[model samples]
Target: MLFNLSRPPTALRRSTSEFLQLCRQLPSARRALYVTSRSKTMSEPKVISVEGLSSSEANVSGSLRNAPRVHPPALMASVAILALLRSESNKFPPSTIIIEQYRPPVDRHVVGLISEGESPEQTAIRELEEETGFKASGVVQSSPLLVSDPGMTNANMKLVTVDVPFPENLEMPAQKLDPGEFIQVRIVELAKLRAELQAYERKGFVIDAKLDHLASGFELAEKLRQPKSST
Candidate 1:
């Protein structure tokens, strides 16, 4: 872009006195300032040309002060950071389920186990015999299994449960049970299972997954206990 300046008088070169006088009247500053009287705006030094210079020789200089800079969103970078933060830890929680098998369609008086190798449900039935000598009338569908102490212990166990009808009293076949292993057989009422869960939670005991599932099936035993609900 060429700037138009008033033509210089042909006597310009010899008039050093006049140029020096003009320079003395101009103020010097860190940044050159150009005032546009037409728009009342301040701008950077722009075009400059010698009055006698041809348009081809004119100079156009623009201020490099301002130009907007844009950047990409940081979320992409943060999402990528998750991979670096992933843990190298192997610590894992234990899992197990506690079960009590019932006899037929009765209370949730489920069977428990005494040893391993027997299907966990088998242990439940065996415990029924050892504790009360009652054969599990039948097995429930898909009883829960768990690592009761996923955090601290290695007891990977499952609990199988069934409903047991009340006989004259809880009876154990002495021959089938390791009499030395079991000390007591207590009959917990259907109403007490929820309290039992609360107790386990208070103690920070992980409910055996097997028992958790069993509990779901056995839910509303109290409702079952209501005489009106029964057929």
Candidate 2:
């Protein structure tokens, strides 16, 4: 089933923060959140806390579940796509950019949230189709775990690309965005991206944000910089 792509209730902030503070240590913990810990000795169930942080996720999940407007899917894997394109003007690239989420009521990055039974790759393709409304073929895969903004949430994201020609076949119903996903996508060329790394407006910035998350971002970005063969 498609995961509930909604915001956690306001009350859960304290809990989320507490748990993340702990699990931020382990390497896998970067993308995965703390779930539970099995208590060794007990007639009662063992206490589980965030993997690293002093607190665990179960407590938060239980509390959040009982809270008003709070649903399940307490911890979920969020997958996303990165689209690259070659414009008509130049054989090379002006740049590759990830489309920002369409926002109104709430604000979120544009990512393909994987369903419970679905694969991350599927989520990537499905999300791209819905968000961009452009039926793309051939999705190149990369390492799945992502950590652009590690300080905020322990969100597990992925990077994938579907190339398309630019200069205007891009038709997307920007108005019909998943609720809460606000976006400010910029189709920045390599020169600009290189010129202003720090100053780049991260209105849901895609490529550079997850600098550490992606070992390949720099390498791939370089390929985009080179002029493509016209053959």
The C-alpha RMSD in Å for every predicted model, in order, reads: 39.1, 14.3
Residue range with the least summed lDDT across 10 consecutive positions in model 2:
1-10
Q: Per-residue lDDT of 1-231 in model 2, one digit per residue for the tens?
A: 011112222222224346445445445212222332323443532221222223347566322111111222334456656555565666565454544221112213356556788766677667766655544466765564655444433545656665656564433334334532333334545444444344423322233344322324665777899998998
CA displacement after TM-score superposition, residue 120 of candidate 1 (Å): 2.5
Model 2: per-residue Cα lDDT at residue 132: 52
Q: Say which candidate scores most in lDDT.
A: 2
TM-score of 2: 0.45
Q: Give candidate 1 misplaced runs (Cα > 4 Å).
A: 1-117, 166-176, 192-231
The 10-residue segment of model 1 with minimum total lDDT is 77-86
Tens digits of per-residue lDDT, candidate 1, 1-231, equal 000111112322313355335434544220012121122242532211112222222476433222211221221100000000011242222111222211221111223323334454455555555444445565554323444443332233343434443333333244243321212222333334456665745744444343344345556664686688466
Identify the leading candidate in terms of TM-score.
2
Cα lDDT, all candidates: 0.32, 0.44
